[model samples]
Target: MVVMMSPFKGQTGFKRILNATGYSLAGLRAAFTGEAAFRQLLLINLVLVPLAFFLDVSRVERALMVAVCVLALIVELLNSAVEAAIDRISLELHPLSKNAKDMGSAAQFTALCLIGLVWAIILLG
Candidate 1:
């Protein structure tokens, strides 16, 4: 069977990197503009990541602190993407659709909680 490729798929080497970076930046912009939760988490990260750098913690602690926040942001992006995909499939209510969206939301919540736990343990310990 023949396979179709993405618009950016055929490029190689430096061109591929440029295309990929453009796509990534576009995704980030879309997330910031379209997803309110993502925008809020990004604002939180803007504060937390800088604080992580200036804290008295060890390098590992700083890294972990920053990483957990980034993880939450990443998870939120995935959650938004999932919600968009499900909505694309149909706007009508369905148990499976509810389950998929709920699970995506749960994943984002877990990641956010993990970020909180990491920050509290590192900053308060």
Candidate 2:
């Protein structure tokens, strides 16, 4: 069997980590600036996440709460990536493009629903 390594894996030590960090920051900036949904979620998280720490949750519960919220942001980033890729491919209407975008949105929605359910169950149940 043959194994494939990431092109990024060639660089070792602190410089590689720095480059990866820079790439991540750039991606985050792009998502925040270019995607309205991403921006909205970040703002909402800014308020909700810190508030989560002050809740009466146990350590595990608090971690779970914050994790789900962060998952929503991750899903949104993926959705934005899908939309951007589709737009890059073409600006015209196409069924496949719509499907790709909608599926991305559906994934994000599912993640968000999970976040809501976690908070509700842990806090209210």
Candidate 3:
């Protein structure tokens, strides 16, 4: 007879949540240590989070603003990861590496523009 063991057998819901939260915090720390753009976005979030509360925005507008900020940060994090991996594979300059880095930078630029557009629409419309 084979006994099946649950992966989360000993963990309560709250404990699992806390564990996941801690892991996320660690990831953010790693990103900040390794990525300059992540640090900039984090600083932006620090300012925007307080501004969101004071703007007297509607629930939907506030949610949209927060979502866009988070999305931009996420994209920047991915771009940084890609650049790091490319650098790890080869320290020498390569066309593909240049292309990858350029594309990643473009992606971050696009995300920033989207955040601005969303905020403008929400605030003006």
Candidate 4:
């Protein structure tokens, strides 16, 4: 028996960076193309990043807000990727695919909740 490896396996540092960039771009494109919620979230970020500067927030609070927003975007991107992969595999409904998609959605929801919590604490405290 012979073991076969993937053709695209073992990426170097530059390749890793390129792959990440590709994924990020793909996620952004998918968000813009397919997900209205992601678009809304992005618009909210656009407002909040500048608002952070205007507010009398401490450096740490600003950092936290930035981190939370970035995390939310990252998670949403990952969720979009997962969904795309699942759909690519099959458009037909499957329990495992549903589970995977649901889990990805849950991850995004968790990230959104964290972002909300961070903003609430920083702005309201």
Best by TM-score: 1
* Stretches > 4 Å off in candidate 2: 1-10
For model 2, residues 52-94, the per-residue Cα lDDT tens digits are 9999999999999999989999999989999999999999999
Rank ordering of all candidates by TM-score, starting from the highest: 1, 2, 4, 3
Better of 1 and 2 by TM-score: 1
Score candidate 1 by lDDT: 0.94
Q: Against the unseen true structure, what C-alpha lDDT does each candidate score?
A: 0.94, 0.93, 0.88, 0.87
After TM-score superposition, the amount by which residue 11's alpha carbon in candidate 1 deviates from its true location, in angstroms, is: 2.3
Q: Backbone clashes in each candidate structure, one number apiece?
A: 0, 0, 0, 0
What's the lDDT for candidate 4? Answer: 0.87
Q: Which stretches of model 4 miss by more than 4 angstroms?
A: 1-5, 9-27
Say which candidate scores most in lDDT: 1
* TM of each candidate vs. truth: 0.89, 0.88, 0.77, 0.79
lDDT of 4 by residue, 1-125 (tens): 99898887778799889998997787688788898778888887898778878889999999898888888877887788889899999999999999999999899899889988998998899
- The 10-residue segment of model 4 with minimum total lDDT is 23-32
Displacement of the residue 31 alpha carbon in candidate 1, Å: 0.6
